[model samples]
Target: MSDSILDRANKGILGLKPYEPGKPIEETQKELGIQNIIKLASNENPLGISPKALNVISTQKDLNRYPDGNATNFKQKVSEEEGIKTSMITVGNGSNDLIEFVSKCFLSEGDNAIYSQHGFAIYPLAIKSTGASAIKAKAKNWEHDLSLMKELIDKNTKVIFLASPNNPTGTVLESKKIEKFLEDIPSNVAVFVDQAYFEYLEEEKHKVSFNLVENYKNLIISRSFSKAHGLAALRLGYAVSSEEIAEFLNRVRQPFNTNSLALAAGIKAIEDKDHISSSIEINKSGLKKAEEAFNSLGFEYIDSYGNFISFDSQQDSDLSFDFFLKKGIILRSLKVYEMPNHLRVSIGLEEEMNAFIETLHDYKKALDAG
Candidate 1:
């Protein structure tokens, strides 16, 4: 037999499951020979992008120059917007980059990280890539069981990953419970609160993650521009922590991890408060419409704080997902999150939401006929 080049990978790497992204619109359309497809699979902004952001990116004159290594201007802008210090932030290409950086910085082969069952998939993936072990606490009511997480933490546990308004389940951890949990955990173990969907929440509804960051040295809050900011295509995200932690993360971070155009877009996106408000308003309306449709269909859904909702599917979610695809609509099947009978749908524009609901109704009719 010929010598194999693939045999050189680490044993753990061979068994890892590659992240399965939602099917791209172009690829799905090509495969099915259909046009006019509605995509509610990926949690992208249905309003597209801010006009001010597009204008700023189009007039870029410094394509050849390297970006600010420290992301000084971006940090300043974020600090101004969030009432947090520039020293408290570390920018990333996306939040995924920050997650990987945390995994590399804090975890070794014998170390462990705790996350909940049905949590964000990246937690386990990031932990595993560092040759560390993952401990999953069983979810309660499809949400993180903080008590179980506390029970699982040992001396070797270096980090814990929790997402408020968690993906696939659309569950939000209450602020008081999280505060209590943070107080209970030892000071050494870092706790990361992923707030990718923060903007979608109302003022009263937003989790108090950033508020607790200073009180606990081990706390980190990760935010992203991919959702309500309408900058998902630009791949901009950031984390807020103590200055010491930020300094250490910066040491491990790659130079120029974020591109110039993306930086320009993010700066412009943040400055355009009108665009941001409009996006949230649109999401609120879309959420109402989606919830109404789910009720009309007699489907139970998690009342979500984010811009997406996960609902119980009448049939196997994999089959229901296939049905949606055939109808030129796309929804996320939650089999990867261990919910085989549920599908998550991102809040889209009014017309897009109507199309998704109509397509789903058609699937039900077809099932009845059969």
Candidate 2:
């Protein structure tokens, strides 16, 4: 008999746990035999896609031809919009792809990458897959502690992952703090700032300066069309960096990584300013509603700047998750992020958010009686 396949797998692959995505509304409905299920798990745009984006996708006729291998049009549009040269932009299947690309381009066996304790799950996964050490710097107040991150940086450190509105916790680091951190880091090490929820932030709080890319050759800023653009289904994201860094990332990127439909949708989505504004307005209102509901219910939650909030269930998160599922409501359990008593809910339409709040109240009442 042949040796066990596990024995032949890479060392990194052996210890890695696959990413668990939020349950789909349709899947839950089929399993529970319930209709009209509400999903506030994944942080998806509740406003749906812009009509302009839909128009572009509907006119696509060429399915057999390969996508632009270089993603020329998409890059050019983004470059003009962001005031960056086309040479400094690299398109990906999603921002997640860019994260992996950076990891592959720099990390290797014996190298180490640093990230905050409660940072995005993909950071560690991408780093570990490269057979590199994933260093978790202790977070301060559930946010990135730049000083702590600098302390963890050793000679083996090759990359650092920083998410402004960090996932799972929704903690944001101020722009000035990040600027100071960047000034102190060594030039050889690369810093990747993932800004997937950037458009959701209020105008006054748009503290991140993309122009920093021009000054720091090692800084890479990755953004996604999936969130604010309502193009998650299309899966388009891009990275902005110095020409040298972008060239390195492009060298490692697979050709035609983004499909043609996604390319077309992204082009239109970027120009749909009104739709984006509407999405942000809805999210702000929904977030306020959720905060008020959580406060009245006496549930502790993180102060969020993103489109989701991580709240303490005050009970076993798995049990809470199961309860919500049975009630036709889907929320995210934070056990994978090491917060077993915390659950995250994405901001949805007013009616959908109300449904979740009512269901949660019922769950709390039931727990109190028991």
Candidate 3:
């Protein structure tokens, strides 16, 4: 046999690019020798975890014992709240875990998975990891063009992933439009909706995904405690779908996929309405601050419903990304999403946003000086 280790790897793995997360504050401090770092890159909750969620950590005991393999309590709590049956919910380490579970369960080499052009990097990564073909439907104004996405659906289409208020761009596809799109698609093809930022949306836009799950047997809706719930560190998320879809997802999901800490904190996190409310209220204020500055600076930005925003860079995006990095700020560059001229910033606390606004102004001044 040939002694080539490369030959043993899957062909799909050869071409795949790993997901790039936002630079961590600790990493920035070590690399740049900067202590005062503010990160507006990963779309995390700037206000931090709720007191109720925090209170559970002190009570957690028996680290030697494994977590509930079936996530029974998680399903029951979610069922009580969502009016969805316990059989219809599957808990995971995070919403991304559920997304990957779906791909691994159903997709194969000949199968093709559809996603928006500017979709989350994890979508294609998960699809490709399973040796499935990833098809990109061109986006309109950085929003998913459902018509274009639907047209590409064919015999081999196993999954179509949609993101409302999609990451990076933050454009929303209306509930009615999504409903209509659901009406038009064939039942055999599964449509997975990532509503990871669901709690961050306004009252009118809330229930956009859940309202459709009951009517569509093939639909899967994913939600997270990472965003508005301020439990990103716990990495807890849940998905709602027909009992049939949840069954398949559970089959591929690893045993005890969700840790004990995430489950305990998540149960408390979901109950803390006050904490969620404050996150949204503060995010609204922070978004307004960033947008006003972007407007005054003459940068065009997509109208966003999520906790983060991306705007066009007047100069090379790399220059601006570096400019912010050197000043103890971490921002995301959208080059990986094929939008090389834009930069994404997650909404932060008042002081963090103030620092960002000041640094942004300095960058603008530097551009002018050059």
In order of appearance, the predictions have TM-scores of 0.96, 0.98, 0.98
Query: Model-by-model lDDT, in order?
Result: 0.87, 0.90, 0.89
TM-score, candidate 2, is: 0.98
- Full candidate order by lDDT, most accurate first: 2, 3, 1
Model 1 C-alpha lDDT per residue in residues 3-85, reported as the tens digit of each score: 57667655445667999988899998999999988899889899888999999899988788998888888888999888999
Poorest 10 consecutive residues by lDDT, candidate 2? 200-209
- Model 3: per-residue lDDT, tens digit, 34-143? 89999999999999999998999779998799999888877788888887789989898989999999899879899999999999899999998888999999998788
Task: Tell how far residue 66 is off in model 1, in angstroms.
Answer: 1.6
Give lDDT for model 2: 0.90
Off by over 4 Å in 2: 1-3, 203-206
lDDT of model 3, residue 124:
93
Clashes of each: 0, 0, 0
Clashing pairs in 1: none
